[model samples]
Target: MSRAAEAAIAASYKALKEDFVSNLTGGEIGEINYVTAVAPVALVLWSALQTRQSFFKPYTPLSFAVDFLLNVCAILLATTLYSSTPIVLNILLLAPVAIIYALPRPPLSKKPKVPPPKTKDADAENPLPKKPFLTIYRGAMLVVTCLAILAVDFRIFPRRFAKVENWGTSLMDVGVGSFVFSAGVVAARPILKEQLAGKSTALSTRLYKSIRHSLPLLVLGFIRLYSVKGLDYAEHVTEYGVHWNFFFTLGFLPPFLALFQTAFAYIPSYAGLAILLGSVYQVALEFTTLKAYILTAPRTNLFSQNREGIFSFFGYLAIFLAGQSTGMFVLPRKLSSTATTGTEQRKRLVLTLGAWSGFWIALFMLTTNYKYGLALSVSRRLANLPYVLWISAFNSTQILCFCLVETFFFPGVYKATTAKEEKEAYELATSRVLEAYNRNGLFVFLVANLGTGIVNMTVKTLDVGSRGAMGILGVYGGLITALAVGLDLYGISIKM
Candidate 1:
């Protein structure tokens, strides 16, 4: 009860404080966890190593580097700054990315990539491509959105704004919506092409394939539900569902689009139907007052929450149609063929597409104003008329801008004249790191979902600070990127 006793107690208190500070600042996120990222990172690291000197095409070093840097900055900004940065900075950073992309792409100096050897599923008619940066944009949006949602769900970010009634209210909402929208467009490409080409897109074949693809997604969804419900992970029912089969809906949606394509072959274009049907469906939802029901009621499961999958499918399908139509316009052209005749073809194509994009943007603004903002939300759950229009307009403009850059101003995706040309083209133009991520996006998405669950369980995400949060996201994103790149290097992809 004297000086020695008092000193002992003071020392114990100091040690405890040190430990608490360590846990907060230097827990699981203190260092880059290489184990978590795996072989995919290694594969990308190798590719990145080769391109470390320069990512630009061999001849046009400065412009290519600038464009690539701008693109990376935009994606990085979207990833780290969306929730934190000023609105003006977001506009300033993003506008230039779009402008750089909008500038005409320069002529290809290298040879083109050979189309993958023909398989049963290959489309041999048209070739030549730039990086599938749009899907990269979509998937990156999904990845970023999911990461932010995890921040909230794991209590790394506070739960102050997680609203149930707000339609596409958060980045979380847009994240899930972008994934669905991108999938719809990419998944339906072949069928849409078949329809346009007047080929017989057999329903039986597509139907069977749909069921096969949906099965895995359905299984994965169940696994996710179990992980959340069975494990003591943070609850995020509305992100997708409490027990709703969200993946099942995604799997089922594309096949439905394919079947619809067969039946509605008379419909002139995917874009027309997207704008028309999306608008009408949204009007119906509003007129019937069904929109409100769908938004608020589904608290427990899929339908209990106002026919969640059933109703949202209509809006999403419209997005899918719009995506398909956009793909038709942007993806089908051989940029080399068009760009060979100076910038006239390139400029004209850009103007025409840009005009169309402007038309859609105007349509979006008009609808939003007239509907009094009812149609403005990019809500994943509602996916109403406004949401479809918003995404379509944005995507259309992005495609126009990106194509212009690739076709006229930049020369990253060179056209192949022969097999040798294609091989050389890939070696010269490919950002194996980015290309890898873009190609295996679905797999990367699945990995991110699983990784999120694992991280929450193993680490005290709630204990993480802002620096640690960035570290966690960086590690997770890097892991997914690495894996996707690795799979691509192995000539594998998870298309379904």
Candidate 2:
């Protein structure tokens, strides 16, 4: 080939790469919300299916396959083939299917004998009631994240559902925010336990522990940076800045938050602290030059090159704090139950979560209202006030829904009277596949990232037809599922 022709080909490839992910404005709020609701819808279906003895009882391979289809493949289809479809329509379609499966079977002519409780007790030994909702919640986040990371590369994937260049909400935007919020919610327990216990560790000790826990993420961040640069891969520099990745954002958070542990111990209200920090950060953006600096600064130095990640750290911190507050607030109490008290406690827990969810949702609307309030736009890049509120609200609401579904549909999981029944109900209510994803989420994510990179490198994802894209996604998702489920069956959890 002529040298001129080779150079021209290279230049064309460069332009194609840039245009693939550039200058998006994101989708409408209603569309994003509708898509997000798919998780709960899938959950309802899974719950309904689990209750049926005639269906996949005793946890066979076929049962796991069905679980994967309902939880993972359904989501993939929703975000791709049905990306434009209304969520309500999907729910309407799924509701009757769930109801049919959920209908009670006619009882056996003779009642089966109740087995004696197992002598080696696990649930009995553990005092705290299991929180299945949190597990499902985390797994849902992972599923969406794994899907979006690769799906965005395909032409069939909705462009509006991709990350926005600046202001607006999208499915990917919600994915990123929910990821951080869920991380916060999970990390909250440890922080709360330390702070609320009135225990003091040496500053050096806390810092060391925090950094130790964060080192894996930092190393992973560096690896990603090196690989992307070395491979000359296509990238959106503005998404996380030239050198910054999400791993760095996650890695830096722990040690930074550790600096405030001593202060947080006496502060008493993590929720208030979150509000104050978020408000102050918003003020700085609106009233000062920080916003301009973040949005327009030239990539002249390390900080400038990574301004998005650096400046947005404060906002993410506020989000983490808010999650911590939520974790503390929702820590289940060992309430004595009666007809009245059981009903009251359940109502109170659901109501409080619902109220907080409503508060944040309303706050998001108010802050973004054009005529009534600050009229601020939501920006994941900026991690500004509306972004924080949207994330908190969405997650709070999702968590609430999960709890409600578990309460109403899968109540037997909690109400099992004996060890044998408890074990069976536990298996029924929980998905082994989702449990695998939850247990090895970070590892699964790493594997998915590698898979996405391999797929992109091997194929022109943009040119793939809907059928071709779906085929590729199915194979990709299958590999991920296989890895997760295999590890889970062997009882091997790879946590870093």
TM-score to true structure, per model: 0.70, 0.88
> Among these predicted structures, which one has the highest lDDT?
2
What candidate 2 gets wrong by more than 4 Å, as runs, is 1-24, 54-56, 92-95, 98-128, 192-202, 331-344, 414-424
Residues 31-93, candidate 1: write the lDDT tens digits: 111111111222232223223333344425453334333333334334343433334343454
How does candidate 1 fare on TM-score? 0.70
lDDT of 1 at 398: 50
Error of 2 at 271 (Å): 1.9
Q: What is the lDDT of residue 32 in candidate 2?
A: 79
- lDDT of each candidate versus the true structure: 0.54, 0.79
* Residue 8, model 1, lDDT: 55
Candidate RMSDs in Å, in order, are: 14.3, 7.2
lDDT of 2 by residue, 277-379 (tens): 8889999988765676677655778988999988888888888877876776565432334423434655677888888898888888899998997888888
